[model samples]
Target chain A: EAGVTQSPRYAVLQEGQAVSFWCDPISGHDTLYWYQQPRDQGPQLLVYFRDEAVIDNSQLPSDRFSAVRPKGTNSTLKIQSAKQGDTATYLCASSFPGLGGHTNTGQLYFGEGSKLTVL
Target chain B: AQSVTQPDARVTVSEGASLQLRCKYSSSVTPYLFWYVQYPRQGLQLLLKYYSGDPVVQGVNGFEAEFSKSNSSFHLRKASVHWSDSAVYFCAVSIDNNRIFFGDGTQLVVKP
Candidate 1:
């Protein structure tokens, strides 16, 4: 079975530039998530979607960060006017929902991640 | 709100030595716990998880974690450490399966 896939494993940009990271989640997975992982830190959830509907995006920076999953299969996270602080690894993950409104094992499959460096 | 804490930033252990990584969580109700390992330049991989029943759960690569409700802790352990086991370990908590909270992670270095 194919795991989650991410594009542009690495990106380097200058301040004020914009960039986008794409993700292709596993087949049949209903939950897709985007996370930002600063160096030496764990991943912080930026946004998530379940079947094309955003479930939560409170942590997302409304001014600069945006995400969308149009078809419920693929997702894209964009950063407008990127700053040096935006330098981090963007991780994408997916998981299948369990029955009865609860999670089954709660295992998340992740991609290699897109590492961004804003100079 | 649910949160996870990994107090140890880094730990070093000799090869073949027993290893233990500590994790603590804060939640109002019972939480689904998980331990993930991330090798250099790789994404996080599930090591093990605990949902209900049985305080101890076995994971891949000879790893196991014991969940303690009284102490609100879940610690990863291995009987013998291998050099390949060197990686960043993250403890996570899932309240509703929609979102998961992860710790800062504990970097483990196994010396041969």
Candidate 2:
């Protein structure tokens, strides 16, 4: 089975520029997430969606970052007026909710991630 | 709110030596724990997970994690280190299935 897919693998941009990252999750997966991983750090959740409804996005930067999953299968994360601090890897992950018993410890599948550099 | 802590920023060990990476969590109830590894330029992969049942859970590549509810910890260990095992390891916790909180990560270096 194919895993989560994301693109472009890398992106370089200047300050104030805008960029978008896309993600295609595994088939039948109901939960999709976007995370930002700074160098030498673990991924920080930006937003997540269950089906077409957003479950949580409190950590997301409302001014510059936005995400949407229109069809509940594919998602896009867009950054407006990117800054140098935005330089990090954007990771996309998916999971089957409530698959692992009551605790729902199901594994998450991630994509290769898009490395963004804002100069 | 649930959170994960990986105190070590980096660790180095000779090949064939034993390895252990520490993780601690803060939660009100019994939490779901996971260990994930990220190789260079690759996505994070599941090493193992612990929800219930046995405290010790085995994962791929000889990696194992022991979950302690009393101590609020889920530490990863391996009997012997391999050069290929060098990667960043993250500990994550979740009270519910919707959100997961990850640690700062620990980078492991296995010397030849």
Candidate 3:
């Protein structure tokens, strides 16, 4: 089976520019996640979705960052006005929901990630 | 609130030597713990996870982690490491129905 896929492996933009990262999750995976991994830092969860609805987005920078999964299959994360601090690898992950609501499949399969460099 | 900490920012070991990466978490509840690895220019890959049951769990690429409730830690271990094992390892913790929190990460260098 194909793993989670992301487009534009690398992105370079200037401050105040806008950029978007796309992701195609694994087939039949109900949950999708977006994470930001800065240099020498671990991936930090930005947002996630269950089907077409956003499950959590408190960590997301509300002013400039937004994400959507309109069809519940593919997802896109956008930054309206990128800043130098936004330079990081953006990763997308997917997983299947488990029988119990609290217990998910507990495994998150990740993509190659989109590395963004904002100068 | 919960968080993860990886004390060592970098570790160097000779090839064919045993390895251990320390991780500690702070949470009031029994949170789910995870270990992930990332090769050069690659995304994070799951190394192991601890939810319940056995304290020791095995993962891909001959990696294993032991969960210690007393210390609030889950450390990754490998009996023998190769040069190919050089990478950054991240420790994560997640509460029920919440997003996963990850540590800064530890870079492992296996010198020949």
Candidate 4:
């Protein structure tokens, strides 16, 4: 099975610049997620979508960050007017409900991630 | 709200030594827990997960985790460590299969 695919493996931007990371989740997976992973730190959930409907975006910086999964198969996370603090890897993950042979286990499959550098 | 915690930021073990990575979770009810390992420049991969039934669950490459409800813990363990086992491990919890949270992760360094 093909894994999650993310585009622009690396992004370099300056303060106040804007960038968007794209992701194509595995085939048939309905749930998609966006996470921010700083250097040497684990991923922090930014937002998630079940199909085209967003489920939770409480952790996302609403003022500058936005995500959309128009077709429920692909997603894009955009950061407007980026800052140095936004320098991190933007990871996209997808999971199908009831995986791992257990009901609603939700085992996540991650993409290699798009590394963002804000200077 | 549900969250996961990995106490150890980093752990160093010699080859062939037993290894354990601790994970604690906070939730109102029993939640689905997981352990994921990430190799250098790679995405996170599932090592094991626990929901109910057997407290001890086995996973790929000789990885196993024991769930303790009383302790609210699910710790990953291996009888022997290899240099190839060096990687970052994350603890995660899912509530209602919609919201998921991950711990900061533990960096495991296996010395040869």
Candidate 5:
């Protein structure tokens, strides 16, 4: 099976510029996620969707970051007015909805990630 | 609220040596725990996971993790390390059917 796919593996932008990253999850996966991984840090959850409905985005930087999964298969995460601190790898992941409606217990499949650098 | 912690920032060991990476988590209830490995310029790959029963869980590439409820710990281990096994490892936690919380990560360097 093909794994999750992400476009623009590497991106470089200047401060105050904006960029959008795209993700195509594995077929039939109902849960799609976006994470930010700063250098030397683990992936931090930014947002997630379940069949086009956002499940959680409390950790997302609302002022500068936004994500959407319109068709529930592909997703886009956009960061507006990027800052130097926004330089980090943006990772996308997907998981089949857990059995018995337990979404918290499933294993996740991840993409190679899009590295964003804001200078 | 859920969070994970990996105390070791980096660890170095000779090839064929045994390996252990520590992880701790904070959660109100029983949370699902997972270990993932990320090689250079690659995405995180699941090494193993523990939900319940049998504190020790086996994973891909001869990796395993033992869950300790008392200490709120889930540490990854390998019987023998290979140079190819060198990578950054993360411990993650999740609760209430929500998003996963990740650790700061631990970088492992295996010397040949």
Candidate 6:
């Protein structure tokens, strides 16, 4: 089975510039997640969607970050007016809801990630 | 407050040595716990997961995790680690279904 795919494995932008990262989740997966991982740190949740409908975006920076899953298959994460602090790897993951036997343990499949650097 | 904590930022051990990576989570209720390994230039992969029952869960690559509700811990262990096991390991917690939170991660260095 083909895993989740993400484009632009790396991105470099100057402060105040903007960039967009794209993701195509695995087939038949309903839940998609976007996470930001700084250097030497674990990934932090930014936003998530369930079949084109956002489940939770509380952690997303409303002012600068935005994400959309239009067709419920592909997703796009855009950052406006990027700052140096925005330098981190953007990871995209997907999972089928109520998965992993009868327990629903929710195991995610991740992409290699798109590393973004804002200088 | 940090939901999940991996106190050890890095650990080094000789190849074929036993290995243990510590993980602790803060929650009133028992949540689903998972351990993920990130290899060089690769995405994070599931090593194992913990739900109810057994307390000890087996994972890929001869890895396993022991869940302790009283201690609020889920620590990953291996009988003997290979040099290929050198990577960053993360402990994660999932609550309210799929809402997940992750730890800072521990870097394991297995020297030959």
Can you write out model 1's per-residue Cα lDDT over A1-119, one digit (the tens) per residue? 98899998999999999999999999999889999999999999999888899989999999999999999999999999999999999999999978864553378999999999999
- How close is every model to the real structure, measured as TM-score? 0.97, 0.95, 0.96, 0.95, 0.97, 0.96
TM-score of chain A, every prediction, order shown: 0.96, 0.94, 0.97, 0.94, 0.96, 0.94
List-wise, what DockQ does each model earn? Answer: 0.73, 0.66, 0.64, 0.62, 0.74, 0.69
TM-score of 4: 0.95
Model 1 per-residue lDDT tens digits across residues B43-74: 89999988899999999999999999999999
lDDT of 3 at B17: 95
TM-score of 1: 0.97
RMSD of each: 1.2, 1.6, 1.3, 2.0, 1.1, 1.8
Residue B88 error, candidate 6, Å: 0.5
What RMSD does model 6 have?
1.8
**lDDT for each residue of candidate 5 in B1-112, tens digit (9 for 90 to 100):** 8889899999999999999999999999989999989988777888998888999999999999999999999999999999999999999998855588889899999999
How good is the docking of model 1, by CAPRI class?
medium
Off by over 4 Å in 4: A99-104
Q: What i-RMS does each candidate reach, in Å?
A: 1.6, 1.9, 1.9, 1.9, 1.7, 1.9
Cα error, residue A95 of model 3, in Å, equals 1.0
Off by over 4 Å in 3: none
Cα lDDT listed for each candidate: 0.94, 0.92, 0.92, 0.92, 0.92, 0.92
Q: In model 5, where do residues sit more than 4 Å from their true spots? A: A102-104
- Residue pairs with colliding backbones in model 1 are none
The digit string of per-residue lDDT tens for model 5 on A1-119 reads 98999998999999999999999999998899999999888899999999899998998999999999999899999999999999999999998866676573558889999999999
Give the local distance difference test score of model 6. Answer: 0.92
Model 5 docking grade: medium
